[model samples]
Target: MGRWEPNARGRLERAALDLYLERGFEQTTVAEIAGRAGLTERTFFRYFADKREVLFWGSAALQEHLVDAVAGAPDCLAPIDVIAGAVEVAGERMQERREGARRRQAVIVANAELRERELIKLANLSAALAGALRERGVDDPAASLAAEAGIAVFKIAFQRWIDDDDRDLTSLIRESFGDLKAVTAGT
Candidate 1:
């Protein structure tokens, strides 16, 4: 059986973020992360492939939540409605992690490689959302459009949420969604 550490992953993530914030992302090394966590480099690797994986642990969970939400949305809802509901559900899960998320975002934004990884992650998520919409019988460009729009709203809402602690992600998501509709309806 594999060795079990109750909070190994969490410790590693915290340590990595702390190091990233102090020394910057590209400057932070895996050994330094492991040392800060009071664990070995081997233990760090046990939890993550490398240092970049440190900031991304919650992303996989968020994607799964979004996928589940879209898949389970009521059939009567439109595509955007389904996406909004999914975003709301995913947003709720992130409320408690806002501070950590903000810090992680700072690290990603400050580094080129991290930013590229983030773009790739978002693209994968958008594609997944589109595929889910297709499974719900949405047509070609419509599904792609709806998914990308939802992601754009999500991105805007996230920025607003991180900037203002009092801001609710779901409300921002809805407002941004409305903003998109209003802007597009004029054309």
Candidate 2:
């Protein structure tokens, strides 16, 4: 089998995940991760500020995709609908790289530290989404609520996608959004 030659940033992320899974997050050293990725510690520093960042390094790009989705959505759509659209768009991006998505999830699942980092990323994503909504003239409580709800839907959908053997992420996101609507409707 051919080994993937990861880009500098991706190499650090993959190395960190591998080390976290094998030896626990607290026990993994930056030097070990750099060695595994066939890079120097200085190269790792150029990509991530610290080891904890490996779990969150891609989040900025993900946030940008989400914001772009919301910004480019048709103006006539409802606020929640716009959020749903953005979530769907983000899901499509993730679906394109199934193996990477699986490995990322697996790494997070295998380590409590990584799981905490994942939660923080989700929270930050929600804040970014809310900020995007506000930029589109959405007001306070509603914007925050919608963004948080959308992120919850995204999380549930993402987990469902990882769990199901047959369903794709886009479909899972759509279904999860519908489910979220149903839950809120009942409240």
Candidate 3:
């Protein structure tokens, strides 16, 4: 009800997720989300492109973080190791917001469109990582493969982390990466 609302972005995200969980993503509207957040539709637009973006607004930042991590990694590390470290750093950040991650994953899993969008985001992340590896002198195929594998490890670990409340995401990511290496090593 005031001209200046603190944390408008946070308020909008919370309202959108709550409405999506309550009424289903397809049934929720921007107007309803804005009303629930006690902000005008114009104010909501200032924070998010649309209602669906509320769930995915962090994708770009996450991608940037991963890319920067890989770029800053030591040259002695292998491509996969660089990716692993990057994702672990990301996991630590996500661990700080575990509940929000769980809720967002739930919303994405329940909707086909959202799941597709999630996949696209992952694909983009993988590509960005591969590019970073190439910048570090890693060749094709190896870079792409390592990047894809890293995303796979991150995805699996993220799912397991959300499902098991007792496990931390970084631990799960390490376990998943170890599993990947084991499978590749044929042992």
CA-lDDT, candidates in order: 0.88, 0.86, 0.94
Error of 3 at 14 (Å): 0.5
**Candidate with maximal TM-score:** 3
Ranking by lDDT: 3, 1, 2
| C-alpha TM-scores of all predictions | 0.94, 0.87, 0.97
Give lDDT tens digits, candidate 2, residues 69-185: 988888898889999999998999888777667777887787787788789889999999999999999999999999999999999988888877699999988888888878889
Candidates ranked by TM-score: 3, 1, 2
Query: Model 3, range 59-144, lDDT digits (tens) per residue?
Result: 99999999999999998998899999999999998897888898888899999999999999999999999999999999999999
Runs of candidate 3 exceeding 4 Å displacement = none
Backbone clashes under 3 angstroms, per model: 0, 0, 0
Candidate 1 off by > 4 Å: 1-4
For candidate 1, write residues 48-149 as lDDT tens digits.
987888877667887888888999999999998998899888888888888888999999999999999998888888888899999999998989999999
